[model samples]
Target: MNPASPIRIQGIHYTLPEKQVGLEQLSAEGRLLSTPETMRDFGFGDCRVSSVPATVLASATVKALLERHGVEPGEVGLLINASVLPTSSLVPRGEALAEFPSGESAHLGLFRFSSTRIQDELGLINARTVGLSELGCVSLSHAVWLAHAVMLMEDLKYAVCVNADVFPDGIKREVVYNVCSDSACAVLLSRNPEGMHLKRYHTLTRGYYWDPDGHQNELLAAYFPTGKRVLEKTFKESGLAREDIKLLVPHNVSLRSWEILSRFTGIPLEKIYTENIRPKGHSVAADNWINLKDVIDRGLVSKGDHVMMFSFGLGAHWGCSIVQV
Candidate 1:
């Protein structure tokens, strides 16, 4: 595999749960720690809630992507699960201690890997399964970068990166005033250069803000500056100027935050895709991919058009990736 050969995104698909919950309802149900007015001010209207397990949503997206692209199960050489939540946990962490006094259930939960389950269910017998976590919302970006590297090294045919996340029942849906939705997204990468071409990626991890809950204000303070630096570095690596970016595939955080970032980075706010912010809210690692897919579907971009993807994981990881459509 030549290093110069581009790894392309052959296809992308995402699935959200059928249930949609509004901010008012979430606050009324105590699922939100913030007031409904605050969330609305942040540009959040409604978010999808999942009635099924995270793995089920993940598998659904992958299955849909493969079927839509006519990709065979045996053709996928790598399966990467980038979901932030536990896929196979039989019980919540709080209940595990009480239900399994001997810790047998805990051990079983650890052994029940979500990646393998998706592989088995999808009959991806030739694919090697890997799970990535702790990067928070940046997990999917890292997973895609890993797949690109591994596929190049192993000379693999196809790699599938899947990410799904859902807040547990009775858990808070609001995180620092941003509402979250349950969603799963799958991106198919191949040597075939028919889709978006993978260009360059940059990631920065600030270990000092490792404790997200403890340092919420500090994390918010560092987001824009760190994100600007990341975007500049990513564009420099891609050999493209900021003006070359046709669109900014942003993570569904907040419209106001994106406006601030756009102003700071000298990228116009119109270049950032924000249509999904109010309707879909944020879906952790799946936001960028989902937005990218929609952008392409709407014919907002053309062949050879460059798009920049950026996200800040709550674990203090900042990532930026550039791709050409």
Candidate 2:
């Protein structure tokens, strides 16, 4: 198994919560830790709040993707789950996880076994499930990388990588300068030699800033230098130049942060897709892959496009992926 061999991106699908909650609404609902005006100052807007369990959304999206692509659950050899909430957020399709504060305390008991439950829900019985966490927002991109590695090393035929989560309370919504959205993204990777390829991936973690709040200033200070390093290193590994990238498919962070990163990395702002930020807010698990789906769905990339996806997690982890599509 050659390291450079292609692991085709077979499909990418995601599900957003049905109900949209405005920034002002959170304050009115008594869910915001800060004032509405304070949240709005960061470019926060309407983000989805699902009345249903996170697992229902994730499983439904995965099922539809498999069916539409004529893929069977049994054929999926690996299930790499990138969801890392503190509790089990999956519930009935129409029931809001946010409505249950009592059940949340019980989620801790079931948290370790969430991947098995998600596997059963999606009927991916043949899939050997693997969980990823502690990377915060970069977990999904790392899941994609793991999909590639597992397929190459273990000779797996297919992997379904899912990144999904929605907060049970509006109080859990905001992360620094970004508003968190509830959503899930499912991406399929197949052992194909000539499809969208995961060309290069680089992940780095600074454990010192593990406490995001205590080190807010430090996190802000290190962000630009760290992002530039990760992006450049990933590009170098992929045998591409930063300026040659077709697009910067970001993890739907704030536009201001994206602007800073664009100048720091020398990738034009126009090449970065930010249209989804307003409607999509930031889903820690789903951002990069969801943005990738939006880009491909909107016909923004050609077959040979060189795209870069980068993400930062609160636990001081930065991960980026360079792909050939």
Please give each candidate's TM-score.
Answer: 0.94, 0.91
List of clashing residue pairs for candidate 2: 51-95, 51-96, 53-91, 303-325
Ten residues in sequence with the least summed lDDT for candidate 1? 92-101
Cα error of candidate 2 at position 31, Å: 3.7
Task: Please name the candidate that would achieve the greatest TM-score relative to the true structure.
Answer: 1
What's every prediction's RMSD, in angstroms?
A: 2.9, 2.8
Candidate models: Cα lDDT each: 0.85, 0.79
Please count the clashing residue pairs in each candidate, in the order shown: 0, 4
Mind sharing the TM-score for model 1?
0.94
Question: For model 1, how does the per-residue alpha-carbon lDDT over 20-109 read when each residue is reduced to its tens digit?
Answer: 999989998998887888888888899999877777788889999999999999999999999775542223344321122236565665
Q: Indicate the TM-score of model 2.
A: 0.91
Query: Considering summed lDDT, which 10 consecutive residues are worst modelled in model 2?
Result: 87-96
Residue-level lDDT of model 2, residues 102-221, one tens digit each, is 455655544535567778877888999877767789878888888888887888888888877867754557777788888888898886665588777888999999998899998899
Cα displacement (angstroms), candidate 1, residue 170, comes to: 0.8
